[model samples]
Target: MVVVFYFAAFFVATEFALVQTRKSALESALEAGKGNRRKLQTALKMVQNLNEYLSTTQVGVTLAGIILGWIGEGTIEILIVDALRIAPISETGLHAIGAILGVMLLTYLEVVLTEIVPKNLSIDMPMKMMMLVVTPLHYFHILFYPFVWLLNVSAAAIIHLFGLRPASESNDVLTQAEILRLSRNAVTGGMLDKNDLLYMQRAFDFNDKIAKDIMVDRTSLEVVDITDSVKTVINYYLRQGFSRFPVVANNDKDKILGYVYIYDLIRQAQVDDRILVSKLLRTIITVPEVTPIQGLLQQMIQKQTPIVVVLDEYGGTSGIVTDKDIYEELFGVVKDEIDNVSSEYILKNADGSYKISGKTTLYDFERFFRTKNKNFDESESVTIAGYLLENYKVKRDDVITIGQFDLKVVDLNHNYIDWLEVRRHAASPDEQNAPQDKPAEINGQK
Candidate 1:
């Protein structure tokens, strides 16, 4: 009985530990040469063929359970009857009592010793339990190969009958959502850096974003006219501090000829300042505004281009997307020597209000506010400025009330809000009804 119980416990521990241990961790350990090479190799094989080894564990557990019930239970019942034979009771009633006590005692021993204890220990320290049991488990698997094969075949057939596929090696792989959840848990447990977690989260979002989400709007672009002189092109580059500019025909952005690099212009200008900007232009790739950034990134790599022009449905230039824009989307803002050291997207004031840049992404805005306002639609816009434009006719010094917060446009450049002052207001009936400057007209309506 004692030996059979140990056998059952061993299989139970192996079952839980094999499933709980991460295959990546084992592979990493093997690569780093941390443990016994031979043992780690064997363990990896067991994990790779997890279904077969798990079947072997099931077979071992079933056999142990049968043997314990058939031999151990009968032996215990007989002992109980003999030990209580002298008790003052009829033989039939005494025998019945002994039988009941025997079953109860055996059940308690099996559950606590064979099932619960080892299961938890394996869960708590899966890798340690895996190392301890892997060798014996491998031997047991080989010895029960025939039984395990039969069980697996039968299980697969049953699964097929239900129109479901049997489990495979890929079952152990984690999905993107699962990996994100694990990263969050790791951050919570202090096992991962917050910035690393943020980057990982952004990586998942990277594919879902389109070129329109990160492109510099056409209105914000600085272009060189095809008719411009070499000196004029050089002056534009020096003043704007940009290394390259799109060459447009007749000062029309929609008629993009190509792009010109600063080096090309400077080299040409040294020879003759009369050189046309069009003569020094290099070919530029153009993509639709709706193109997925993931596929766009691949195109950029294949063509060896760092910038691409984005086109609208009308075949006119919508904007330009640069490698820097994509990099910032995935890794957050990167400051260079040209960027102001004191500039920030969002700043908290001493009076509890926040001064935020109009270009701040809606995701970061919501994260800082720690609330999701139903009034804002993420699908309609990506930035605070875009969201305001879509929902309200925003103008300089315009104050717009949204949910529990009030947003005042502090600065405006043309039609775009450049900066905003945000304040959270208490939810009071009097405050809601107080007379104030008229709120910005919604969607251009009076």
Candidate 2:
């Protein structure tokens, strides 16, 4: 009975060790980087190696335990009577004592060999243990691969024969969303850090969104005339702080003939002295304005390059996005050399209210003031501008209230509300518990 329990404990400990090994090692490695932690890294690495062997080495331990338990009890009985000539064969107490000793020895061996040492290693130098024992354990796997494969196939067939579904392995397991969830969880649980989680979270957000979500509005795009001199284009590239330029004919952006890279344009400028746009321009890598950021990233990685040109439905250069744009989504806003750091929205009025673009989302306004919009309804639209259009029945420059969220339509275009001043009405009970919409950006989608 004691031996039976010992074997059971061996199986439980080995399986538990395998499950805890990988994440624990990863956590140790990450935390060790925070301090002068060479010792911690070394210790975790040791634990990792032990776990790799522990998982596979159990097969040997189980067999050895069984044999020793049988021999120590069964053979020792004959040995005491024949060799020692001390105990009679019919003595129950001697037989009981032999079995007890044998079982105790087996339990000690099982604990030392399978549980205590491996668990300590697993909880300590997990990384070192993994690195040390992975190869040997893998070799054992390969050695027994043929038999394991056969047994699996036979077991599966027997299950099917009984009119039951054999356990099926799917071709696809986790998705991009699921993996992001796991990464987020690891960070939250102290297994990973806040920065790493943010980076991964940004990557996922970037994947879900398309060029339109993060692209600089077409109004902000600066382009070059296709017929311009190399000297003329060079000045624009310098002013724009861009390595690439979309070349349009007569400032007609829709009639764009590819684009020109500064590198090529400059190289030709030296050779030709009077370089024309046609002779110096590089072809564009055009993608739809609405193409998902994920697809763009794949193209960027595959090309081993980071720039892409976004085009409109008519195939005109709407705006250009760089590999930097995608990366910024992951790492946060990357300021260009020519970026206007001082160009900020200011409340230019005594009313603590100011004129703002119609296109601005209310969410930004609310968060900017560190206050909630009591007059507007977030459930109606994701942005402040969207909320105004959806919940308002009268499209006039009038203050409207929805669920205590208020918005004063300060300006309106001929057809649409172009700009507005917005403020929340009062403390709203219902609005406080509303769910926020998903942010429109992602990264590292693949």
Candidate 3:
């Protein structure tokens, strides 16, 4: 009876040990960073074969367990009847009780000796675990190699008949959502900080970015009209503080020639300062203003042109772009020796209104209003200053409303409004009452 109980316990322990060993082998070999990478590579090749083989192995292990259980119980019954002088029916009762006790004992013993201990060791030192067990696994494979191959071939053919191919190695993995999840888990586990995790998520979301989000609208473009004399053009180039300028055939901006570099313009001007404005204008290289930011970048690279005049279908100049425009796409709004460190829309007075340069876009004002503006291409006006001047029937200290937004003409010039102020007329009352807990709350909060 004791022998039977001990044997039953041993069979259960072996059953769980086999399961743990196989699980440990599979996970250890498959893990990306841990375990023997070489073994993993080798294992990938055999995964299909072993996958089929392991299914059979599992069935065998289960059958072995059931048979061993029956044998253990019958032997224990015989031992109780013969050795302990118990009657056959009494032996059967004892055997039943012993079997239940044996199952409980086996459950605990197998957990400690097989599943729990082995799994802990495998996780802590996957490389060591793989090294110790890979040879055994390999030997097992060799013994069953022919059968595994046949099973894999059959499976692959069946899969192919269904128009499916076995999966192979790949570099691209971990979708944006998965990466975000992993980053969140990493932060929770102390493997990453909150800021770093957020940055990673933003990086994944960056490719969806559009041109309008980071464009320097026409308000910022520097242009030279072909009607201007060569002397005027040269003087404007010298004074404007940029390396290139879009040359238009007339005041009509849509009749753009390509950008003329300061170097090229200067070199040509040196040959003849009196060079005709027509001859001075370079051939135009223009792109639709609505082009994707990535498309613009690729076109710029392929065209090998530093400056691309932005144009509309109705033959209007939307804006002018230089390598600087494309570069700012990568490195957000660059500030160097000549840039203004203060607001691009600076308000000179104590009034909460902005004294924006005419070049400032209506988009900027809309952004200030905390409103979502649909991105679009426009040839009429590029900035808030241009939009205001064009819209105002009578340009004075005149203020007007478009939808919920308001524009006030503070100042104007012959060519462009030198400066102006913008504010939302409707939101003034709301703005006055909204909580001023900005830096005090979120940006300041831990």
Residue 86 accuracy (lDDT) in model 1: 86
Give the Å shift of residue 265 in candidate 2: 8.4
As for candidate 3, its clashing pairs are 219-359, 257-284, 258-283, 258-284
Q: Which candidate leads in lDDT?
A: 1
**lDDT of candidate 2 at residue 136, scale 0 to 100:** 47
Residue 423 displacement in candidate 2 (angstroms): 22
Q: Residues 47-155, candidate 1, lDDT per residue (tens digit)?
A: 8888888899999989998998888778888899999988888889877987898889898998999999999999999988999999999889889999889989999
Clash total of candidate 2: 45
- The lDDT of each candidate is 0.83, 0.60, 0.56
> Which lDDT tens digits does candidate 3 get at residues 173-264?
56888878977987998979987876665555446654444444565555677666666666765444455567666555566665566676
Pull out the clashing pairs in model 1: none
In terms of lDDT, model 2 sits at 0.60
Worst 10 residues of 2 by lDDT: 437-446
Q: 364 in model 1: Cα distance from truth in Å?
A: 24
State residue 443's C-alpha deviation in candidate 1, in Å: 25
RMSD of each: 13.1, 15.6, 14.7
By TM-score: ranked, best first: 1, 3, 2
Clashes found in each candidate (C-alpha, N, C closer than 3 A): 0, 45, 4
TM-scores of the candidates in the order shown: 0.69, 0.42, 0.51
Q: Which stretches of candidate 1 lie over 4 Å from their true place?
A: 78-87, 171-173, 229-243, 260-282, 298-305, 343-446
Report how far off residue 272 is in candidate 2 (Å). Answer: 12
In candidate 2, which residue ranges exceed 4 Å CA deviation?
Answer: 1-5, 18-158, 161-165, 168-172, 204-214, 227-244, 258-282, 290-307, 342-446
